[model samples]
Target: MGFDWSAAAGTLEVVPALERLELLAEPVASAILQLDDERIGVAEIDPELADTAAFCEQYGSPLELSANCVVVAGKRAGEVRYAACLVLATIRADVNGVVKRQLDVRKASFASMDDAVERTGMAYGGITPFGLPGDWPILVDAEVAAARAVVVGSGLRRGKLIVPGEVLAELANAEVIEGLGR
Candidate 1:
């Protein structure tokens, strides 16, 4: 089933933005389409509201209906390893605790904005877990995976994606973690 964008995003229409999905970052668009999940919907939004709080408030969506994907980096045996952390807007990713432990690294920190934007090929405020690098493990919080539908970035500031929470859990390399969000 598709997302009811009229109710979730207020006036936004659910369109076949995925038909032109290449407009999104290459990785994200490919994942969504290739994953074979039919509960995904795409919609446009004002770039100004791309940030979670602004997007949720402006679109009349609750914080719980939004998920934030952050890029994190750490070093293990002198090799840098990066991963994507997905959590609801209502909670924070346990980066230093659960995340570091999960990565089996001594230290973990959010990637710098320049690194995140340049490497991911997505705007700083518009990074989504869907299009992350192949080697990056997508760490999804249990609560986020339990939601019926979630509003996430479209890999650009001008749009957003609506997908079933279970779909997020099914991404390649996705690791659904309990206590990942705090």
Candidate 2:
């Protein structure tokens, strides 16, 4: 089925425990003013597309497409100190050694849907680096900064926010890092 943003907009219900806020609408561009903090801007797009290239082609705006990757430490049976990484669509996160070293955990792994949603207060497939816990390290791919704007999650599953890269960095308190290769 094609992405129906209007339909998604209709399902804006506040999740009780997470208290995560959601905004539903067309593909936003540069600055999600609705967010009071103005940290990261969100963009709405198809969740089915697994790769950034596909998302870019479909949206006709590669510069605005970013991949929000959540890296957890306790994914291997049992662990803790989960971390999330937000990178530009043009690059991939270093899920192996780099992420492990950055998070300073004995082992780092991708978080499960339940863990991600519970920790970040965002829905599965709808998590954004914005508004995440301050203790969580937010890393941005250097390439994302080069773009005039970048697209990130809207704290919801349906729509996305396209906002300035600087704004996202400011909001997430993200640190610009390298090693997002392949």
**Top model by TM-score, which number?**
1
Predicted candidate 2 versus true structure: per-residue lDDT over 29-138, tens digit per residue: 21233344333333445567424455555665443345565645533345466666777655667867777777766666688778777777666665666556667777
Question: Highest lDDT: which candidate?
Answer: 1
CA error at residue 111 for candidate 1, angstroms: 0.3
Q: Ten consecutive residues with minimal summed lDDT in candidate 2?
A: 8-17
Q: Compared with the true structure, what per-residue lDDT tens digits does model 1 show for residues 1-182? A: 44455545555666654665744666677777776555677887888878988877787887887899999999999998899999999999999999999888999999999999887888888899887888889999998898887888888888788877888898889999999999
The lDDT of model 1 is 0.83
| lDDT, candidate 1, at 168 | 88
lDDT of each: 0.83, 0.54
TM-score of each: 0.92, 0.66
